[model samples]
Target chain A: MRADYLILGNSAAGVSAAEAIRATDSCGSIVIASPEPHRVYGRPLISYLLEGKTSLERIGYKNADFYERLNIEPFLGPGYDAMRLDANAHRATFSNGTEIEYGRCLIATGSIPFTPPIEGLDEAQNVTPFLTLDNALKAQELADRARAAAHAEGRESRAIVIGAGLIGLKAAEAISHSVDRVMVLELAPRILPAVLDAEGARLLQGMLARHGIECRPGVSAQKILVDGGTAHGALLTDGTEEPCDFIVAAVGVRPNTAFAVEAGATQGRGLVCGPDLQTSLPDVYAAGDVVQVRDALDGTERPLALWPNAVRQGMIAGRHMADDPLAPVFDGSFAVNAVDFFEASLLTAGLINPPDNAEGVTCDVRIDEAAGTYAKFVVRDGKLAGYILLNRPDNAGIYTWLIEHETQLDTIDPALFDSAPLNCDFDKTMRWERLHAGYPADRNEKGFLVKRECPSAS
Target chain B: MKRIYAIEAWCLGCKRCEIACKTQHSATRDTVKALTQEQPSPTSRVQVEGDRFLSLAVNCRHCAQPKCVKGCISGAMQKDPASGLVTSDPAKCVGCRTCVSMCPFGCVQVVSVEGRDIALKCDLCTEDGCIPGEPACVAACPNGALVYWESEE
Candidate 1:
């Protein structure tokens, strides 16, 4: 097979790159290959699927006719394995003995769930790793069985979820309604330790407790207690045992960069890409969770495994591949997390909790423990560095924009923290310029006059 | 791409734009009846901000790169490539409010309908039987503070 652009892993990044390619090079042949048989779907909705909040048909991120409308070919299913990149020949070979020549290629294999070496895990049944649609389906089936068995025995079912990160908490939240009790065990001292501070985690833990989900931080699962070849419980490191019928390991994920590394592409935590998302090898690019991007807040490189970053990186890579002159430069990437758990909304962006010894960094925190609302801002040199909004997150994007643009706080109104930041927060002249500049003149037929206000002369 | 532009200097702060937007989006489409109806009450998507002398009517910009579209978990909030309009499908919405937190303009609103919350944003009065260039708020603005026009790219 031959194509002008070949993309691996037909998920968010791969599909985005294909769309971007089609936008610039209309007639270029684009092919997307993936081990998953289904078309591109929302990976984040898998948790919603387990909770029965959504159906498989509705989980698709793009429309069914997306590929057809974009005029891109798809090579889906598990037939393709072991992608080997030949930089010299500008081609790639699959384990099934098929080869495809490409003018440019993108590696967006995403990430795989990392299962720790817990004793008796391989021999345990009813244990699933929460990721992908297939894993969700399997977990749902096992949960249903456990529920029915509990109902038959006139009792309630229990489930144990390992890890307390975003994935683990989401899994616990999804299945909480179905199961009688869901225990979330985390080795870290607090839940969402990567993104949330200790106080933030404590607030969230209180909310989870009210909803009947037990969160045990600083605890590890030593072994999966299997009875009759079926997993029934977990032995904790604290000399305790948690009884359960099902277990979901949401510990963490590692980038799938083995193929790229084998092909001589440099790797840090993930495949190292230049500012253009190109790897060391010519004509080979990487995006999504498999690639490391520079952090905008701090001048450091890290694997930002967020969906929006993946889409943006893929678009930039695609534009570069197409040689589009107007291609937007990849500046930097940061983390943005939004989650709604049990009616409590939370949003966190950039560095929520900077290190204690960080120079010239200060923090302003507002905590309303009774109302379960917490707002904190980490500022450095009068610039908005990071923020965490809990419960009342209205206009949270303003903080995100401030952080992303590195806008100096002194330039804006001092009352920004007092209320929700709105467009009115800026000076009237700046606001007018931002709202009206480049806007087209209104047609006289609409009974309105189009007038351009000159801010410079005023 | 056609978009609604706000003239802050000309806004009267009368909030007529808000009433017009709410009435246009209502099920009745009649000013008096729509305001009186108890079931499925309409919520205005456009907001009037600032004081009397300096105020602006703000609504969804329908951005080219909408963060709400990216953060939407259910894939309900979508930006139409052809029309350049970002809209939400209520049938597919799970009322997560990810869009509410993600909109840079703070335009997306979460309204409770029959005890279930769903996101509401300016649809350019597309559902109100208005033409492409005649949004209800634009037509209702007597001061010519709001205008809808197509911009040449």
Candidate 2:
């Protein structure tokens, strides 16, 4: 069968491109072939799985009936990697050895967890990397069984979490609540070194500590030594041996750009794409964690692995692939992480004082020893720049809006935050007023202005 | 009798309805105070289901053919004569989860405060006249997905 567009990868970019194509060209056949066996599920739920906060069935982006409802065929399983694009014939090959021609194709293979080279890492048993839902469920099983056994025997179930990135921190929090102890080890000098500033990481680290998770910054896992077909613990670079029942490697992910590279497409950190997310190969596009995007803050191109960014990027890529002629809206959106750790929350977006420039507003707020929260607004030239919120983020939507819309600080009163929380009654009214400025509701239609759910309410 | 309706399209899947319902029905007024207080535990009439992609904020339709009122053995659960709202009396509620079992939409919740059980649902925040007057969830919704409508309309 011949299709107008053959999309590779599934999660964010692939499904989005399919939807975009449908929105514009209804007749063209769009096939999304994914390596994953299950439906597209949110990656963040991997940690939540450990706590049994949500089940695998609930974590999926769509149910089995979603594909049929959307009028898209999801070619599931391992045949995804076998999708061979032949630009010469304008066709793709499936592992079943079936050849399908395409007018255009998109590569959104996404990324994989980067497992650093360590001694005895490959042979180690019960050493899971938090990536797919399957791995998350496996990790949960291990944690739950270990916790039960430890409680029965009156022993502490220690779980060694390697890497202090977002995933690592989340894993630590999930396990810390159920396990005897959770120790987070990071190779970098500070937690979230790439994203948050020193102060922000410190505040988060302190918050995690209070939650009973021991965080070890500036430390590296030298080796994953196992015992009795199970992960016992790890030897740190600092010459300390920590005892543990299992290990979770949250070292981050690398874009799966082998096919793109094999096709002789322009490659940077990942598959390089133009402003339209089109790769060097004609009619071929890419987006999500797999495709490298230019930073909106600074022109330096990098891969954005966050879920929201991926979804938006995929939509843009998909629209363009389907030949939407709109002059293009929204910036080449950068990566943003709005993470909720236990009771505390963190929102990091754009460049927060890049090393080259040291000129941005720095704001801090520490609630107390147990409840420490901080806010930093990285402003450049009086316009709303990057901002980070740690520990009990309130009205993050307002700050996020300011950053996204590039709203100038002069238009609003900065003192509003001083009187009440970010989502204060006054600020909420102001926000609502700004959002629905031209068209205001005349009367209370039996309830609120509209039938919408608030973020916290969700 | 005024009725409440949840428009699924506008729902962002926030459980503020549940939270507000529990808070208003609690012994104390404050959120923290409500958490610790015992008896007459608050329960929401609404239930938020679905995924991040497409969510459905579900609640009782105040059905024309109500099954819950018939399922109630102790006569505690009844359709209020004045408002047509599903009201429950804790004093008579026997802690039976029959309401929960009978609810096709799973809108009715039986909450335990200390020990005794009480039935809860959306009573239309008629008492608290905060911010003029509105249901707590409706007032709290950022997306404006839920609202009350007149039964006659």
Candidate 3:
């Protein structure tokens, strides 16, 4: 089989790239393949499903006729996943032993959970990594059974979630709806260490306690206590045992780049790609959680495993591969993440925790624990480096826009940290230009705002 | 495609657009009733910024490359290819507020109704057949501060 464009994943990056290609090359033969059996659905919404916030029907990113409207053929299911890539020969081999010749291809296989080596975890039952839809479904089923067993025996049914990262905590919160007790164990001293600082994590810990979920930091499972092939408890490294019925191992995720590496794609941290998002190979491009791009702020190469970055890279890759010579290149990305647990919401972007007392780096922060609000602004030189806002979502994007544009401090209001930002918060000229013309009208290919002489100033 | 643009010169910061926007999306669809009687009062998607001397009513630009659509984790936010209109489904939002954080214009808003949070944004005032093909915010502007028209670009 031969295809003009063959995409390897069906999640955010793959679907975005397909849309970009279909936008211009309407008649090209496009084929998308995935390891998952289900149609294209929001991968992040799987946790919301367990929490009863979303249903299967609503989780779909597009309408029912998405595939039909685009006129693309899809090879989906467990065996259809890309098994090997012969980049030199322009052929990709699938697990089902089928090879397809492609004019151009995309590697958006995303990432899988990197489960840590815990003694006897491989032989234990009801042990799964929280990454795929199947894992979420299995977790829901296990929670139901644990709930029933706890009622029958008149004891507390417990679930221990390893790795207090974003996925681990979301899994704990989602399963708490069905199970009686959920305990999160983390090797790090603070929860959500990657996104939140120690102060914010401490606040989140107190908030999670209200939902009856306990968090044990500075501890991890030394061994999985199995009884009759089922995980009954977890033996902690601190010489303590926590009784549990189900376990979610969500330690971390690594780029699924083995297939591309076997095909001799140059990799560092992840499958290295150019500014145009193309690999070293002639026609192959890499994107999503599987490729490393330069970090805009720190100027380091790392996989920005976030949804927005994946979507942006996909569009850049699609346009570049679809014969658009002047297409926009992949601008470096900084994190903009929002995680909510029940009523509490936290938004963090860029460098949340910078080096202590770095030259020309200053931090401004405000915390009102009574109202559960925390706002921190980390400024480097004259630009907005990063910020963390908790329980405040109003006009939060203004700060993000500033960070993206690297707006100077002279124009920014000092009161912005205490109140919701408004268009008036900016200088009069900027307020008029943005509200009148809209964005991307004046933005250059690299996403910087091109300054123009203000139209006679308001 | 027609888009709503704010004329900062004429905006008086009267906020009539805000009131009209809320009433149009409200359950009662009446200005007085929706404002006074509706519990958890409906929020206007358009925002009035600045003072009477210089102000603008900021609405969703619905850009060609919408960052909100790209950042939406639940796949709830989408842009209509035919009309270039960007909107989000409330049923699938899950209230993560990722869209709210990513939209540079700060037009997307989140409202909590009966303990469940969902995203609320300007759908061009096209939802529920309100004013057929017109925008209530643009229509209610007394000073002609708002205009809905196609650009020559």
Candidate 4:
């Protein structure tokens, strides 16, 4: 098939690209290829699937006729796989021996779970990874099976979740509600090592403990021991064999950019895409997890696999590919993950890493272990550099806006942070200023006077 | 050229004007059945005051650039071609509530009564059969709160 714009991958990045293309060029011929069997489903809601809070049908991001309404051809597949991107020919070859030609193409292939090799890992039957909807369903099945087995035998069930990252912790929480015991094993010194600092992680560890899930830090699974063709237990690096009914691998993921490499697009940490998401080839572009774009804050190029970034990048790339270029909406992508784990909300933005030379920088932090609230702010050059708000997140929105808008310290009273809600009501003028920023017209139009109308005026 | 006017002052808290609006718009031609029947009572396009204690009537202002009509996703809300009044067809509305959320004045109320979502607001009761020169609200108001007048040059 030939089209004006050919898009690969059908999740956030791919679908957003399709919408952007249609918005820019209404009549352009578009062909989208997806490896997944169904419509785009919100990835964030996949976690809620474990608790039976939602069903597969409720999770669809777009409706059934979304593609039809957009006037785009959807090569949605259970089998349609993109094997190679022939950039020179402006075509892609699928594993099923189907070739699609395009005017311009985008690679939003997203990412796949990076399951590291452990001893006897292949023999495990119920080993599941929490990445796709299928994986979530399969993990739920295994969890239910283990629970049923325990109930039948009048015994307690155990579920081992490897990697105490976002996915691992969430999965462990979900399983803990149904199973007898859920243990989260993390190799890092602290849980949520990448996103949260030591103090933040400690707070989260306590929260998880309250939820009845065992949070183990600085412990690595050395091997998975199978007995009778089933995963019997796992051996920790510390020489401990913990008996478990099922194992969930939520270690992490790497960008799926093999197609980019095969297509001869310049590859480094990921497919090297310009600010426009364009690859080395003329008509080819890469986005989402598979492409490395410069970070706006530090200028360091990183693979941003976050769903929000992917959607923004894909939309920008799609509009550019449609021959209607707007000012590149996404220069690179900001890194922000707002997650709620077992009712404890966590919002982390920017790099948590402080500069090596912290001599001149001033950091203010307040930690309330009892309330499970942790707030930290780094002020560099009189501007907010990084922020971390956990549990008690009422001020999260204000802090996030400050970080995004680069609000200076001069405008804010240092005492405003003292209030639990971050309200500036203590200072009338400051409160008015903050409220005016949110609604400019109300103050500007009305001023400090009320107009009086006579009864006959109506 | 009768102008739709809302009385901000001397307005009673009762929603009789809203009821009168539904009575005028209902195809049933009977007020008792329309008011008492549980199944799909005719919805007045008018909304009672959002702030309950200090009550006021909220209706479309019929602005030059009506935001409710502009914000409608399914093209259900539209300005009358000749009358220049912002109106919505219940048939075309998919009940997305985008208009309700977007309206700055909180003039639109999206109520899910009888298991179907619909927007309620005031349409001046223009289509409701009227006598030669009087609006239903102006006549119904015991305190003479609502007034209808034409703009004079």
Best by DockQ: 3
lDDT of 4: 0.70
1 versus 2: better TM-score goes to: 1
Local distance difference test values of all predictions, in order: 0.83, 0.67, 0.86, 0.70
Model 3 Cα displacement at A53 (Å)? 0.8
DockQ of each: 0.49, 0.04, 0.50, 0.04
User: Residues B61-112, candidate 4, lDDT per residue (tens digit)?
Assistant: 5555454553453345666646665665554454444454334344555555
Per-model root-mean-square deviation over C-alphas: 3.7, 12.7, 4.7, 10.1
Better structure of 1 and 3 per DockQ:
3
Clash pairs for candidate 3? none
Superior by lDDT: candidate 2 or candidate 4: 4
Question: Each model's interface RMSD (Å)?
Answer: 3.4, 17.5, 5.5, 11.5
* Candidate 3 lDDT for residue A255: 96
Per-residue lDDT tens digits for candidate 4, residues A1-458, read: 78888988888788878988898899989888887777777665567666654466656666568899999898878656789888888889887888999899998888888888888666788889888888888888888999999889898898999999988987887788788898889999999887888888888888888888888899978999898778978999899899988999988888887877877888877888777788888899877778887776567887977766776677678878876745375576456666667667676766566776775566778887677688877777777666677865433445544556666777676764553323331243543343222232222222322544458955
The positional error of residue A185 in candidate 4, measured at the CA in angstroms, is 1.2
Name model 4 segments beyond 4 Å from true. Answer: A355-359, A420-458, B1-153
Candidates 1 and 2 compared: the better one by DockQ is 1
lDDT of residue A433 for candidate 2: 39
Residues A1-458, candidate 2: write the lDDT tens digits. 87788888877667767777787888888777877787876556667656654555555654457577667777878765644677777777777676767888888888888889977666777788877777776777778888988888888888888889987887787777667788999988899877788888888888788878888999978987877677777888999898888888888889987766777788889887887888888888887888777777777877887665666667788889888997264356654565667655576667675554456554434444454667666676676566666653433444555666676766666753342222222233443333222232433422345544457944
User: What is the TM-score ranking, best to worst?
Assistant: 3, 1, 4, 2
lDDT of 1 by residue, A1-458 (tens): 89999898888788888888998999999989888888888787788777665678878878889999999898888876547888889888886778999999999889988888989776877888887888887878888889999889998899999999988898899888888899999999999998899999999998998998999999989998998889999999898988998998899999987887998999998888888889888999888988877888876887888777787788888998899899887877788887778788888888888999789898889888887799888998888888888886777887887887787888788677765778888776666654554465443323355675668954
**Cand. 1 TM to true fold:** 0.93
